[model samples]
Target: MGATDRLDRYQPLVLGLFRIVIGLLFTSEGAATLFGVLDRDATPAGDWPFWYAGVIELVCGLLVLLGVLARAAAFFSSGAMAFAYFTEHQPDGLFPLQNGGLAPALFCWGFLLLVFFGPGSLSLSGVFRRDAAPERRG
Candidate 1:
């Protein structure tokens, strides 16, 4: 097959992989929040932000995992990571290693990638394209 055909055939695989990986990562985090596995209230803020973060992670992660609205989910998840990095992780600066804080920065990078690249062409988003072809303009 030609390059175009090959890529088209495997596009779903690529997108699906991205969705699954990111989804699982966020999903586990959400599980942590929903279960209260961590002592969030121990922090000075008393876990107020943790609740919001947990909800976002849980919902967005599941949406992506299900391949439903993967693009939008990924975008918002990226934004969530950005908030974590700037406010919580990066208060000191980009040097995450300085304070054992690479997790948030890494999450931010992953989410940013998801936002720009979009959940690939193999995601539920891709299925939507095939099933919901837009009306052609005159």
Candidate 2:
């Protein structure tokens, strides 16, 4: 097999790594918002959407990282990012650059991908035996 074939064989591992990185980034974002760390101001508790969104990010990010209920968590996370972009970022301008909504837009689409592709080789979902059960194609 050529290098391309070898690379294709490692797709699952690569996917897992991708998921882990995305999850880690998301979790960090939440931590920064909630704890005022990461050189960012903390969202005050009970703040309408920011705080709640932070909580979702923290929880869903961990879930995605762990590969437990990855799809559901990713779906929710994607929605949260979408909501963030529409309500927060899209307001300033239609373009992400103008509104500073790039991060949210990217996160939204990234999580949406997880919703379809699922966690990969490194996920705990397999060990837990609760991973997505694809219908038998026969």
Candidate 3:
């Protein structure tokens, strides 16, 4: 098979894998921030933005991971990442590398992709989900 054909055939699988990895990483980040379990300091409870962001990351990340309402979760996550980048990093520098905004910027775009493309085949929603029947008009 040609390279393009091979890539096309495996695209869904690769997208699924990518989504899984991204979800796992995002969840890990939240866990680290909220519970201090993964060699990261816990954000103090009631802290402005960080704690709240951790909550979002945990919930949305799980939703994205399981491919349950992933589009919605990704939408929110993307927005949050954009917010984090603009508010926290953009003021420091214009470039992502210079501003320490790489993660947020990448996540924003990545999640935005998910929001549009949807969770690929290897998902809970795909396994047990059924399309609703169309109603007949009288």
Candidate 4:
């Protein structure tokens, strides 16, 4: 098969895997910041903004990982990452390399992509689709 055909055939699998990985990473960050997993410091539960953001990350990340409402989860995640980069990293400098904004920037764009493209064919939504069967002609 041609390269395009091969890519088309495998696109869903690749996209699903990508979504899983991204979700895992985002979830880990939330876990670390909220629950102190992976030897990372836990933000105080009562802390403002950071704690709230962590909650969002945890919940949205889980939704993304399970491919449940992935587009909506990814949309929220993308916005959160953008906010993080702008508020935390951009003050240091305009460039990501100079400001240590790479991770947030990547997450922002990655989630944005997922928001547009969805979780792909390997997702729960795909499996549970109400109209999965092809229409029949009378």
TM per candidate comes to 0.71, 0.89, 0.90, 0.90
- Clash count of each predicted structure: 1, 0, 0, 0
What are the per-residue Cα lDDT tens digits for candidate 3 across 59-100? Answer: 999888998899999999999999999999999999999999
Instruction: At residue 94, give the lDDT of candidate 4.
Output: 95
lDDT of 2 by residue, 32-82 (tens): 989999999999999999899989999999999888899999999999999
**Residue 131 CA displacement from its true place in model 2, Å:** 12
Ranking by lDDT: 2, 4, 3, 1
Candidate 1 C-alpha lDDT tens digits along 76-113 = 88888878777876767668897556876776677667
Question: Which parts of model 4 are misplaced by more than 4 Å?
Answer: 130-138
True-vs-predicted CA distance for residue 98, candidate 1, Å: 2.1
Question: Ten consecutive residues with minimal summed lDDT in candidate 4?
Answer: 126-135
Which 10-residue span in candidate 2 carries the lowest summed lDDT?
126-135
lDDT of 4: 0.90
Tens digit of per-residue lDDT, candidate 4, span 64-135: 988999999999999999999999999999999999999999999999999988897667877778468687
Highest lDDT: which candidate? 2
